[model samples]
Target: MEIRPIVTDEDHAAALREIDRLWGVEPGTPGGDRFDVLVTLVQAYEERRWPMPKLDPVEHIIGHMDLTGRTQADLAKLLGSRSRASEVLNRKRALTVEMIHKLQSEWGIPAELLIRPYKLDAA
Candidate 1:
């Protein structure tokens, strides 16, 4: 059980191979223990090497609308104004608390997602 930190890509590859060899081993045994540690190390290395980008609130809203077959006009109805919906979608305005509440209540969009700070268009 000569496990090492996954530093370089070569090290990562080696750990993966070892993990494959140790796969399906009985838990609480030597091989299974090694497998667990290696998997954790590999996961950490992958996260650092290829971190995921945070979801943009507007993009999430658009994606949700697409998935649910909702349109901009539908969003306007929810927001009480077509111009306000356009402004929010176009990054011309930030989502207000009332807008967030409406989205959460009516559209099931999570408030936390909508609350995240996002870039706005320069004036």
Candidate 2:
């Protein structure tokens, strides 16, 4: 197998095409080995070329709410109460450690994502 570091966009594109071509190849086979190596190379290249920016906690929460078609009330339920939810959503209160834990546990959001400093306007 001819393998190389994915350096250029062309290299990345070729790796992607190879991955597609070898998609669903069973493990322990020649094609599968090629697929695995290509995926690793592609991942490394993408990480360098397109580093992911950390999402703001509030924005992330809002986005999840939108994507899931959840209402403020639903968020309130996840947060334990309506007033607390309102306070959080309105930026009247910062997320406390306990609240962050709760969000991570109940909503499946990463606590680290929720632990970042964020602006909270006065109530």
Candidate 3:
């Protein structure tokens, strides 16, 4: 396929096929250069057409716990109070800056993800 801007789904599909054909192409070669440009164009088109949703801080914490074999009790221990942990996990309380710092420093959760605004329970 001729190199061009990926504007439509057809263009995206064609680029993907070209990328597949160019897979494992040797770097610093003409085919490799085409592969790189097509990959970048496809990525930009996908991001502009279908942006990812923001990460939910609470769900992220829960997912981390699940992945690490941690539990609510562990979260309670980290947060220094069972009720506080519950409130935060249940979305009844928002995470404070202190909590964000603690999670980042202790659990290696990125402060950026934790700092994003998330919905809380009304009641």
Best by lDDT: 3
TM agreement with the true structure for every prediction:
0.59, 0.82, 0.71
Clashing residue pairs in candidate 1 (N, C-alpha, C atoms within 3 angstroms): none
lDDT of 3 at 41: 98
* TM-score (C-alpha) between model 1 and the true structure: 0.59
Candidate 2 lDDT tens digits, 1-123: 378999999989888988998999998798888899999999999999999886778888898889878899998887789998988888887888888887788878888888889877865
- Against the reference, the lDDT scores of all candidates come to 0.92, 0.87, 0.94
Model 2 CA lDDT for position 5 = 92
Clash count of each predicted structure:
0, 0, 0
Give a tens-digit lDDT track for model 3, residues 1-123: 999998999999999999999999998899999999999999999999999876799988998899989999999999999999999999999999999999999998998989889999986
**Which of 2 and 3 is the better model by TM-score?**
2
Model 2: how far residue 46 lies from native, Å = 1.9
Clash pairs, model 3 backbone: none
Worst 10 residues of 1 by lDDT: 1-10
